[model samples]
Target: MQFMILLDMTIVNVALPHIQESLGFTEAGLTWVVNGYVLMSGGLLLLGGRSADIFGRRKLLMIGVGLFAVSSVLAGAATSTGMMVAGRIGQGIAEAIAAPASLGLIALLFTDPGERTKALGAWGGITALAGTLGYVISGLLTDMASWRWIFYINIPIALLVLVLIPRMVTESKMVREKGAGLDVAGAITSTTGLFAIVYGLLQAVDHPWGSAAVVLPLGLGVALILAMLIIERRAKDPLIPLRFFANRTRSVINTASLFYMAAFISYTFMLTLFMQQVLEYSPLRTGLSWLPLGLGIGVGIGLGTAFIPKVGVKAVAAVGFAGAGVGLFLTSMIGVETTYLGGILPGMIVFGVFAGASMPAGTNAALHGVTEQDSGLASGVQTTALQVGSALGLAVLVTLALRDAMGEIQQGVDVDVAMTAGYGLALRVGAVLMVVGAVLIAALLERVDTKLRDPVAEMVQHTA
Candidate 1:
């Protein structure tokens, strides 16, 4: 189930052009296909996580997957931009309900510290692998059949999950205080706030920075976010308990995740555009080209998992982010005439390896000390950070890139040159953001005892 959701994240990348052309979507409107899913999912994740604890993990997962299948059908059959965006938004809502519950189940099921660590590593690796495969599958589906097949592909996966979940997984929920209610208000405010901000950012592609169309939604989003904070403070059961931030490792990892994902998402978006639109690579070729990066990610995940017992997460994560940043910087050096083998593969491999290593380490740190009770909450926060980062990063970075491209075009730059130039600028900024995350990980993450096994074992025994 998690694989299906994560796969959706990247599968759309390879099919973006097809969807745009089929649906008569403008360049700016096309972003909504991606952002709509990410934005809603990210915004509602806190609520989704809490709901899993308050309701039931298995029940929520089943419901989410069922809805996801339905939403995919809507998206697959859509004939207009409005229907497609609506379907994607529905998919996001479904993912929000399902994703944290899936992770929460894994965290709770693997109680042993070493086992939990390995499980998390496996989870990260599988999902990362799925993200990579999404491109390949999407390419094949788009070229051989139709882009709509990408969404239709989820139906069988969802049906299988629905059929198997009841037999394989038991229901689980957190024990709550008497009279506690779901944080519906917090969920509404956060989701709407994020949507407004993303909408405002997308508007920048068409409207001036000072235009009311851009300013109003941005302002509304900010105000709503402020309201959300206040509401959470007063709510009987907040979606995101403020005290969750007290865990230094979790807090720091979550913070760094935002920056990490922001840079990474933008990097992928730009690279996809560069390959398909600028380099004229066929979807199949473009998807196959990402094979190296995917394999690198798999290798890096293994290395990260093995090294954590020796050096701890801080050092491993810092090095990973730093290396990934350098890779992005290198990739940004490409020009309009550059070939993939000579120009793109090196950076993709570098970025893939380091980025992959960082994922498991970050997950370990973020979920450290978490028990079954708050497993859903921790998972939700981690996922929320990444998704929100993805949405915001894509929104901001794409806007900046398009802005640059337009400026260059106005100055009489060649169309391809302007496009590549804009993409290059965005990728460099993404590199800087990655470096920033690395710095935060290095400085803010406290050094742990190298004997992680002994401490984790002891902690588990104490809890038991």
Candidate 2:
């Protein structure tokens, strides 16, 4: 279930051109095809998480998956930009509901700490693999079949989840709220606030950063988030308990995850554009180029599963971030004449490996000390960070790229070369973001690991 949701997040990237051409979408409007789904999912995740805690996880999972399937059908049939955006919003809402419930259930199913760690590791690995597959599969489908099939593919997967979930998974008991009901006020405020901030930031690509058009929404967004904090503090049943932030480790981990994802997602998006738009690779060839990245991620996950239990989550995560930083830096060195093997492939493998290693470690840190009752909310928080990071990072980095490209275009440079320059700038910035994320982990996450023995590590290594 988790894998499916994450896959949907990026699978459409390779097919965006086809989607835009088919739907007659402007570039600005086209961005929404991706961000609309992300923002909605990120915005509503807190509410969905608590819903899973209050209602049954199994019921919510079924509802979410079913909605996703229906939404896929809608998207696959979409002929207009509005229709595509609407279908994507549906997918977002479904993901918001389903994702946290599934994460909470993982905690519920694995009562033993050792077993729980292994399950979390498996979850992280699978989610990473699925995300990697999305690019590959979407490219293949878009070239050989149609862009629509990228969405149609989700129907069977969602249906399979619906069928297997009831038989394979058991439901967790609802956490009774002490308040009058759901925190409707908090939910409204947080969702709107987050959406506004990301939306406002995206406007920087078009409007001046200092213009009222950008400042008003961004300022309003910050104000609304403050309002949400106040509401959560006063509410009898807060949507997201303020106490979740009390854990220094998890809070910092979640924050770092935001930066980590911002860099990583932007890198992926720009890579796709650089290859297809700049280098003129066919979609099938582009898909094949990503195989090395997929392999690297698989290898890194294997290493991380072994390392996290021994060296600790914080250490592994920090190391992974550093390696990713270097990898992205290498990518920024690409030129018009560079080959895939010489320029992009090595960096892809390097970053892919590190990203794989960080997945389980970061997840473990975010979930650390979360009780079964609040597990859903914690999972939602982590996932929200990821989605928001992707949206925000893509917005900022792409703007940087476009801003530069537009300058060159104004100077009468060829659009393709100008765009390549833009990609280079963004990739470099992404590299810096990775370094910042690494610094944050070192500065903050060191003590997050328990000094005491891990039973899982004991069983694996039989060591000190």
Candidate 3:
């Protein structure tokens, strides 16, 4: 269920253009279709984590799965822009509920060192695989049927998970004060603040910075964020525990993950459009082209899990980032005449391997040395970094694309040249971002004892 949700988020990217055409979305509106879900999902993650802690993780999982299923159906049936946006918002809410709870359940389920490592490796592998394959799946679905099917496909899978969840998953509640309460004020302020910030960023590409659509929301968002900080400091049960940042490795890893994801998400977004618009590839062909990359990620994860402990998490993570940086550099060289095998495949394979190896190592590093009590919050924070990074990356890349395209038009370049120029600019920027991430990983991630087996094993055993 966790893998599927994560996969769906990426898979929809390949279908974006088709969705835009079919739904008659203006450029800004189309971007929102994707950004809306990410914004809400990222914004509410901390709250969702707290909810899982207060309620039972299993209970939240079941509710989240059901909500996601219903939202998928609604998205598939959407006929207008409003309907689609509404459905995406629902999907975001559902994801916010499900993601952290699912990770918490994983932490609970595996109580042995070896078993936990294997489980986490599997989880990381699946996440990387799903993210890469989302493009392929979205392309295939969009080509084979309508873009609607990209969403509709989630329905049955969600249903199956919903059924299996109740039977297989046991309920566990957070060990907290009996009278602990949800931070209502914190939730409202944070969610609205994030939404406003993201909305402003997205609008900035099309509208001037001083424009009402851009400035007003951006200003309001800053104020709201300030309000949230004040509220969290005073709240009895804060939605986000600021103290978690005290762990140097955890804080740095999360920051690195955000930057890494920004590069990754932007690459996926720009690459999809490049394949269709510049390379003139069919959706199915584009999807099929990614098979090698997806498989490579799976292979890399397997290898990393086997060898990383022997070397070190920091070493493995550094290597992975280096490989990803190289891949991004290669991708930046893509042009209109570039062939899939010659131009894109090599980079894809490199990226796949890096993503596969890095995600598990990064995730393990981020959560390492944290107490069991803070595990749920740690998981939520990691997930929030990913979603927020993705949204922010896309926003930044899109802005660059728009800027480059406009400049080319002003220079009287042909439409094709202008569009390709925009895409190339985004790719170059993504590559730079990846390099930055690599440097951070190399500098900040220390040599942790990876052979501790499962860091959470002792805690889980005691609880059980």
Candidate 4:
């Protein structure tokens, strides 16, 4: 289930062109195909997590899987832009409900410290593998069959999850106070605010900042976000407890995660374009090119796991971010004449390794002090930061890159050269952002014991 949800996040990158052709999507409109899933999922994740705590994790997981299967079929058969985007939105909502619940189940089931560490390592490994394989799988499916198969493939996975969840997992939830209720208003305000902001950014791809098309949504979005924050304060059982941010380690990690994911997501999107549009590589070749990155991530995770007990989460994460920043800088140096081995491989390897290493450290930091009752909430918050960052990064960075490309085209630059230049610019900015995150992590992330304990599971028991 985790693999399927995470797979959808990257699989669509390789199939963007095909989807555009089939659905008659404009360049800016194409982002909706990706954002619709991530934005909805990110925005509603808090509610979904809390809902799982209030309802039952197993029940929510089954519901989410069922919805996901239906959404996949909807996406597979779509023939119009609206339909495709709608289908993706449905998938995102389903993911919001399922992902944290699934993680919460793992936390619950693995009570022993040693068993918990192994379970989490295995879970994180699967997530990395799913993200890595998504591109290759999409390429093979899109080239051999059709882009629609990417969506259709989820049906079997969903069916299997639906069947197995009931039999294998027992139901569990947090024990809430008698008067507690779901925070529907908080969810609405947050989700819609995020949507408005993303919509405004997308409009900037073609319209100026001053234009009402851009300004209206941006203004509305900010206001709604503020309203949501205010509402969270007043709600009896807030979607996100404001005091949760009082935990400095969790707070810093989540803040840095936004920047980390923002850079990473935009990097992926822009690199895909660089590979296919500028280099004219076939989708299969482009997919194959990403293999090194996956391998690097695996290696990084292994090294990080081994190092965290010696060096601490702060050191591991800081090193990872710094190394990834350097990798992004190297990647930004690519040009029209550059070959994959000569240019792309080095950066991908460095970025993949460091990026992979940082993930476990961040996850540990975010969930470090959380009690079992808030396990789903903690996981949801971290995932929400990542998903929201993905949407925001892609929207902002991609818009800047396209805007620069358009400017170059006006100056009579060759089309391919202009595109390459724009991509380079975005990557450099992303690299800088990554470096900034590293600095912040080094400065702000609280220091903890360099012990080889399962922080989350043990801490949950300790706090409880």
Candidate 5:
């Protein structure tokens, strides 16, 4: 279930160029293929968590899995851009329901904290593998079959999850405060605010920065987000309580987590483009090229699991962030003629190593001192942060890349070269984002110690 939910996040990326050609998507509009899924999932994740608490976990799990399977068919059969986006939106909603429920069930099953830590460690590993597998499997499917098979692949997995839920997983207990109501307003405002901001950012690539077309939506989006916060403060049963973020240490970890995810996911997005577009590697080759990264991550997660008990979580996180920042800086040096081994391979391995190291520490920090009931809610919020960060980072980096590419085009550079240059610009800035995360780690998490953890693994740990 975790694999099915997280894999969809990036499986489409390797197939993006093909999907664009097949569906005739405009360059600017292609991002919606990703954003549509992420935005809805990110927007509704908190509500989805609450829904699990109000409704039965097993019931929501089956509903979500069923919807996911049905949408996979819809996406696989899509013949137009609208149809594709609709399918993706359906997927986002399904994922919002199932992903948290699936994860929450994991926590409920592992009653012992020691055993739970090991379970979450395994969870961390699987989550990392699923992320890279999305690229590998998507590339294989696109090369050997049709890109549409990316969507087709999910049906069997979802069906299996449906079958296994009843047999292998037990229903979790539900909690409802007497007379408390859902914060429907918070959900609407946050979702619309996020959409508005993304839309404005994407549009900025084409229009002037100060254009009302760009500014109005951006302003409205910020206003709406502020409104969401206010509503959270006032709501009887807040979709996302503002108090949830009041822990200074947790707040800092999450902030750093957001930046960490922004840089980490941007690297995935940019590197895939770099290999396919500039290096002109086939999808299979491109997918295979990431094997070192996957291997490094596996190794790092193993090491961090061992090291965290000895050195403490924050120390490991600090070192991990520092290493990841350096890796991204090295990646930023890629040129049109750069070789894979020197230019791409080492950087990927380094970043992968650091990402693995940071995962457990970050997870420990996020879940430290939290009680059982709110455990699911904490996990859901962290996942939302991961998705929102990934989406926002990709949008910002794409906007910057496109703007740079436009300038290069105006200067009469070849479109392909210009595009690579644009990606390079995004990559260099992505390096800065990683470094910023490292700084936050040093300042915020270095002295903190977490003795117990409550289900902290992210899809991004990724927030895995």
Candidate 6:
């Protein structure tokens, strides 16, 4: 269930052009198909994590999965653009509920250190694999069937999972202090603040930076976020514990993850468009083309998991970031005549390897030394970084692509030339962002392996 939800995010990218043509969407309008889901998912993640802590994790997972299934049906049957966007938003909400709860449940379920490490390794591996393979699956669905089928496919799988969840997964909930209830004020403030910021960023692609559509929402978002912070500080039971940021390693890793994902997200979204729209590859061929990249990521992640306990998280993450930068730089050099085997494939392989290796090490570092009390928040923070980064990345990249496409068209460039120029510029910018992320990680992360024998004990001692 976790893998499927995560995969769906990237899978839809391959069919973006098809969706645009069928729905009669403008470039900016089409972007919301992706951004709508991302914004809601990212914004609600912290709340979802807290909800699982207060309610029951298993129950929330079941509800989230069921909601996702229903939303997928709605998205597949969407006849109008608005309907599709609404369905996408619904899907995001479902994902937001499912993700953090799933992770928290895993932590609660696995008590032994060795068993937990193995379990986490499996989880990381599956996530990396799903991300890589989503392109292939999406491409095949788009080419062989209608783009709607990409969403339709999720329905049966979700149903199967729903049936199995109750039987297989044990029910568990956090032991909160007496009389604790959901933080309604915190939920509203945080969700609205995140939505405003993400919405503003998405609009910046089509609207001028100074336009009211862009500025007002962004300003409101910033203000709401400030209010949320003040509320959190004073609240008896805060949704997001601000103290989690006090740990230098955890704080730095979260920041770095956000920046890194921004680049990675843009690259995947734009690259899928380039292959299908600009390069004009068949869906089957496109799917097959991604195999090497997918396999590479699986291999890279396995190796990183094995090495982390030896060389340490900081060193592994640093190397992974550097490798990712090199891969992104290579991707930026691609041209209209670039061959898949020689040009695109090599870069994909390199990227897959670096990304695969980096995730485990980074996650380990971020969650290291966290106590039981802080585990859910730590999970929420990490996942939030990823989703928010992707949302921000896509918004920025789409905006840049639109600006370049418009400029080229105004300059009387041919349609093909204009489209290629926009995509090319977007890829180049993505590469630069990856390089910047690498620098941030290298400078900010301290070389420390805080995955001690008893993380809770360490945290308690540190507090004392």
Q: lDDT tens digits, residues 1-464, model 2?
A: 87788678768878887788899986556678877888888888888888888887888899999999999989999988889999999998998999989988887787776676788778877876787788899889999999999888898899899999999988885646365467889988988897788778778778899998789989999999999999999998898888889888888888887888888878877788778877998777777787787778878887887897788888888999889888998888887788999999889989999988888788778877776667788888998888888778877888888888889999999998888888888988888888888888888874543222234556688664
Arrange candidates by TM-score, descending.
Answer: 1, 4, 2, 5, 3, 6
lDDT of 4 by residue, 338-451 (tens): 899989999999999999899778877777677778878888999899999999998999999999999999999999998899899999998998899899899988874322
Residue 276 in candidate 6 has what lDDT? 73
Clashing pairs in 6: 205-399
Residue 22 lDDT in model 5? 97
Task: Give the lDDT of residue 222 in candidate 4.
Answer: 100
Off by over 4 Å in 4: 448-464
Model 4: how far is 420 from its true place, Å?
0.9
Error of 3 at 17 (Å): 1.4
Give the alpha carbon lDDT tens digit for every residue of 1-464 in model 1. Answer: 98899788889999999899999999888889989899989998888888998899999999999989999999999999999999999999999999999988987787776787789889988887888899899889988999999999999899999999999999999877899888899999999999999999989988999999999999999999999999989888888878888878788889889989998888887899899999999999888887888888888899998998888889899999999999999999888998998899999999999999988788888787666678888889999999999999999989999999999999999999998998888889989988999998899897542212335567899999
- lDDT of model 3, residue 249: 75
Instruction: Residues 1-464, candidate 5: write the lDDT tens digits.
Output: 78887677778888888898999997778888888888888888888877776776788889988999899889889999999999998998887887777667776777676676677678888877887798899889999999999998998898887888889777775555678667889989998999999899988989999999799999999999999999998888899778777776677777877788778777887788778877899988887887778778878888887887788777788888888888888887888888998888888889999988888778767766655566666667777887788778878988898899999999999887888788877877877777787778777664444433434442236443
Worst window of 10 by summed lDDT in candidate 1: 447-456
List the pairs of residues colliding in candidate 4: none
Q: TM-score of the candidate numbered 5?
A: 0.94
Which candidate, 1 or 3, would have the higher lDDT against the true structure? 1
The list of candidate 3 runs beyond 4 A from truth reads 210-212, 447-464
Give residue 373's error in model 4 in angstroms: 0.8
TM-score, per-candidate, Cα-based: 0.96, 0.94, 0.93, 0.95, 0.94, 0.93
Predict model 4's lDDT versus the native. Answer: 0.88
What does candidate 4 score on TM? Answer: 0.95
In lDDT terms, how accurate is model 6?
0.79
* Per-residue error (Å), model 3, residue 146: 1.5
